[model samples]
Target: MDFSEKPVLTGDRTVLRPFTAEDADTMWEIVNDPEVVRFTFEPSTELTLDGLRSWYGVRTADPDRLDLAVTDRATGELVGEVVLYEWDPAARGCTFRTLVGPRGRGRGLGSEATRLIVGHAFERVGLHRVQLEVYADNARARRVYEKAGFMVEGVRREAALRGGAWVDGVLMAVLDHEWEARARTDATQVTGEPRLYTP
Candidate 1:
């Protein structure tokens, strides 16, 4: 989707910008990290620079997908990434996913980055809903999503085989109304302005 033309989103510690071929190396590093890919769906072989570049080509060509490179705003260092996947134009909803490198872990970057992306998805992209499927054992990620106001809607028992054992998957979602209400509460607390949730 012409992501280069999309507005970059800024947060307290990070910036979300369009992903480019130049980011291949950074992505390769993270995607190959065993700890980083443990609970995720990344391929085991580890992506080579050439493979990443080719993947980037296909990703950038898809109009419905939005892939962003997460960077530390203060140092301009690549920290992680966020993606909005399986977008449904008619339904105006999509699945959200995120990953952080080792250096970016344990710093609340995941939660903060998610908040920023959720805001963009609802307020800027005009999406009706955002959803995600997280590994049941990934408590940290589940907490991040919960703190961002996504409700646990369902669970798939033994949905994936990880670490030589079956694991459940939890489905979470936040609707536009929920996001709007949260935004209103935030605005009222910060600016003393009354806001309403319209959608």
Candidate 2:
């Protein structure tokens, strides 16, 4: 659960890094965006500048969670955030989630950010499992999770109310072994490294 060291993760299309206090104004807009509100939180949720400032202001100090801003490398704007929280030390696991506003959507940035942090969880943090829940209707998110090797566990019926209707929540998880397999495949493909995966 050590969050004192925040690392900057980079991809061709996006960068996942810690936030600065000056990012509050932009992040406030992103966190309060209607799409972000509907998907990642209760629809009735709202935020104020000071509130968001305080929230982002303390991300670096939290001992039990990792919160990193998702920056679209193309535009150099902080489009959203990726988080790992609810630490279970006994199980060496955590829950994963993210937000990508209009600026970052439809470009595969979400999936890239997910892979970056989840890789960190396994390769750097020594986590055994990572899990997430997405509304059944969010096919995009489901696909993203799939690309990251997260297998759907089951359905949580009527798990949430969004847009005046109840939506099924799809529970998905990826164990360290699964991720290791994926990582090995990725490395083999990228660097033409010998694939003697014993995991």
lDDT of 2 by residue, 1-199 (tens): 5555788988878989897787899987777777777778876666789888888888888778999999988888888899999989899999999888888889989888999899888888899999999999988788999998999999999988888899999999999999988889887987698575321
Q: Write the per-residue lDDT of candidate 1 for residues 1-199, one digit (tens) a residue.
A: 2222355788888888877887888888888777777877634454568998887655656667787788888888888888888888888899999988987888777787898888888877888999999999988899999989999999999988887888999999999899888878876887687865321
Best by lDDT: 2
- Residue 185 Cα positional deviation in candidate 2, in Å, after optimal superposition: 1.6
Q: Residue 67 deviation, candidate 2, in Å?
A: 0.4
Candidate 1 regions exceeding 4 Å error are: 1-5, 42-46, 190-199
Of candidate 1, the 10-residue stretch with the lowest lDDT total is: 1-10
Question: What is the TM-score of each predicted model, taking all chains together?
Answer: 0.88, 0.92
- Clash counts per candidate, in order, are 0, 0
